[model samples]
Target: MAKKKQTLFECQHCGEQSVKWLGKCPSCGGWDSFIELNQAEQESLKYLSKQTSSDKQKAMPITKIEEDDVVRFSSNNTEFDLVMGGGIVPGSLTLIGGSPGVGKSTLLLKIAGNLAKSGKKVLYVSGEESAGQIKLRATRLDANEENLYLLPEISLEAIQNEMLRENYEAVIIDSIQTMYSDKLTSAPGSVTQVREITFELMRKAKESRIAMFIIGHITKDGSIAGPRVLEHMVDTVLYFEGEQSKEIRMLRGFKNRFGSTSEIGIFEMTANGLESAKNISNRFFSSSKEQSGSCLTVTAEGSRALILEVQALVSHSTNPNPKRSATGFDTNRLNMLLALLEKKLDLPLNSYDVFINISGGIKIKESSCDLAVIASIISSFRNRPISRESVLIGEVSLTGEIKDVFSMETRLREAISCGIKKAIISTKPKGIVGIKCFEVDEVSKMLELF
Candidate 1:
């Protein structure tokens, strides 16, 4: 006698399984999410089918295999290479997430052009744009690749069939949310569908030893859309972050299994294409002078170091309560810092309206930007202009003490490369030669230097 199969309703919004149907899923707390799926069909295959003559697998010994011996495909761009460590590793799946019109497709297209130039076959699968539309954009980007193939389709099974037939060096999927499989009844972009499709792609990438690039959609909160586990399934997760209004788009590496996770690739959006910004420090600060209420700071993102500008303005408020506003920085953190200043230093903030802005439209969350935030607020209060070449890099404690941050050497090196002579750091930074370094333990001590 055959074994009996189980039955349950699955949540479409959160992929939860339920024994009984309810208006809302108990596991995910979502309404009307339960969808019935065949129990036997829903269960993933426990073991791989026996390989016939047609299905061959790579055979290797655990000890005999050398990771360093694996061949790497260079994207042929220095900045991109840095972000991807040495180069693209084989059998790696990378997910690129960003907002709409953040140059996700443009950057990937440029990479495809570069890979094709080096005599590598590239396959670009676009579900969001037509082949003709991609072609026009590629032409504008000056992409003349004879080996690049473009296919406009959203069927996952069809894409898998094509992958089995072609021998491409690199494969790029425009957006993962649009792709779906017929095996699942869920609609495209649904939680069940997105999770299932990404898992299938991961399996394909591993089995074929092919490097795949997946572009993902971001939620309204600026995080990647789909289940939270989607980020963990990929070998590399990159977030293309920057203000929509600014031309600068920062490619930050949130996770990298093949390389360091602290790397960032800087690119500037141009009419022709996305150009790599080499002098990141100069590019961020060269346009600004000794302006009042503006503060310069060196911050770190993963393995990459950066110099950022922090600006604050204080004005008299007509309302009984003063207004506080901040951009690219945390508003609550600003308020806490203000409270610290008011209670500890007895500064005047209740009567004055305070506003803070991080120049270049880049959002900073690292505590290293704390010193710069304080300096900017003080500059506004005193109506003083911080030196144009001066830069601050440190973290601030709740008790008004300066704290040391990580990668001090790297941050200082980046600042020095751009001709920044002075840096206010939490501790004495080492490994950087021939530069002025001021070590301060408290934020108030910084007021005298300014």
Candidate 2:
């Protein structure tokens, strides 16, 4: 009698493995996401487990280990380099994900062209698009160069063979989801196939000392569509953010071993392609005629400070439970601010509908914009317009007191550069020459400014 084959099931959502089929995954709480692995996939899993567990290397003292001399080269795009923590490092595996038609392909193609122009051998591989299709795009992007080669292939084995044959310095995989491996029986984009292919590419990249950039498709929830381990396997991870209808796109770094992860790269979509925004400081706010329900605030994005507009609308509601909506701002935080206003200022906002919006499609991630949100709400509720020359910078506390925020000096400097004449902050800073500062300690005190 033949020996019975061991059964193995894996969760498609989070890559949790089990010896039997499960209706619901305990790891990610996903329903009906577990699928039994094929014989080949089972063997692959066993091999990987043994390899990882049987590591022969021993731990050494930190000071005894020799440091590695990291090598980096610019992609010739300032915005791209900024998000990448200076530049591209050889043997680095970078994964970029974004929504469809968000310029992932366009941006990478342009960077490939830049590398080629700088006399570096570059290869562009696509599993979805044909060579002719990429060529059409290259023409629009002016990426035609002798060193830039296009390969319209999807097989991982074929790509590896091509890389082995050529002495290319950089490679671009149009998408990782479309690539399949012959070693695995699973279909392309499946958990097993994606994990195996990423592992192989990572090993090959390190061995050949080649820089690799792979594009990933995002899910409906705005996360990269693959096993969570896919992100852990790469050296860097970047996400492209913005609506296709908007001209401005922000590239944010989530994981970067080479540099700071807080840095953001701003790009403008144009006829030529995605280019660094020239006037980034003045892009998020308007200095036009002052209007009610609108206020200016300064927020820090890594090393750069930007002046952003916070808009709010308040109106009487007939329903007992009024509607509370926020765009580009946290809805939960908005509720907290509303409750704070009602308690501290004795405002009758419980029967009103409140709406908050951060202008220019920019999202506010810091609490420093809390004061601006409150100012905008009050201005709209009272039918009063705040001056555009003034900016609100502070964090609101639950105790109805205003608190100072980080990088206050940098934020005020940016406000001054945008022609801001006055600032309302939690605490006034000394030696801020361009803008006059006023301190408001309590929420009730902030209302006096209007």
Candidate 3:
């Protein structure tokens, strides 16, 4: 008698398997995430586990390993090279993810073209778009180079074959989710297929010393789609973040084995392609006359300081409980600020609707912007405008005391370089040649600005 075929339902969100269909994934708590897939036998799964031994052999003494053989190449994109901690390391797997149409492909294509121009044999592979389509885009971006090659294929075996035939220095897989292998019976984007494909590419990249760039699709929650295992297997993980409708985009390094994760690359999207955003500080500040509900602040993106505009709108709430909303800022922190305003600052915020926004689509993760947020909210509540020339820089504590922020001089210098005149800081700052500085010891003193 023939052996019975087995089937299992797997959660695409978390890669959990179940004998029966589940309405929601027990592992990841995602609704209706289970997908029925035919199980290939254990013998067939061996291909995914097979490893090559070109680079890693028996463990040797740490000092014996050769360091001069390691190679790094610049893609010729200044901001891209900076965020990547100098340049792309050879034989490394980098996964770049973003929402649909956030310039992930465009940025890679531009890099591929640049690498090709530098006499590095490069192959541009696209599983989603055809060669003709990519050619059209290359022409539009003016990235058509003599050495740049294109391979619009999806099968992993075919891609490897092409790589072996051409011996290219760099290769770009337009997306990892679209690649499939004959070893796995699941769908192309299923957890098994994504994991297997990533493993194959990673091993091949290590063996051949090829700089590999894998474009990944992001889920609705802004995480790279497919199994989280994909992120762990890669050497570097980058995310392109910004509003789709906006002109600016931020390339952030989420995980970097060779560099600092705090580094950020800013880009401006134009009709030609993505260019380095050099004067981004001016972009965040509006040109219109200063008004209430808006305040200026300086933030640090890694080592670089950026001048930002913090805006808030406070009004009487129609509902029983006032609504609190924040964009590009943490909602919980905003709520804490509101409570602090009520208790410590004696502001009646219980019956008001608070809306806060960090202008220019730049998300503020640093706590140094806390005082500036409070100042903007209070400015809106009191209907008084803050001097555009003045910038608030400090952290606000729950006890309502102002706290000093790191790199105070860097933040203020960025503000002064942008032609700002005054700074509202917690501790007294020194060497402020062009700008005037004022020290505010408590949250209550911030109210005296208006």
lDDT of 3 by residue, 339-384 (tens): 9888877898999999999999888888999999999999999999
Q: Top model by lDDT, which number?
A: 2
**Arranged by lDDT, best first:** 2, 3, 1
Best by TM-score: 2
Q: For candidate 2, which ten residues in a row score worst on lDDT?
A: 45-54
Q: Could you tell which candidate, 1 or 3, scores higher by TM-score? A: 3
Provide the lDDT at 193 for model 2.
85
C-alpha lDDT of residue 243 in model 3: 97
How many residue pairs clash per model? Answer: 2, 0, 0
Which pairs clash in the backbone of model 1?
262-302, 262-303
TM-score of every candidate? 0.87, 0.97, 0.94
Tens-digit lDDT track of model 2 for 129-234:
9999999998989999999999999999999999988999999998999999898887898899888888888888888899999999998888898899889889
lDDT of 3: 0.88
lDDT assessment of candidate 2: 0.91
Where is model 2 more than 4 Å wrong at Cα? Answer: 1-3, 50-54
Model 2: residue 196 alpha-carbon error in angstroms: 0.7
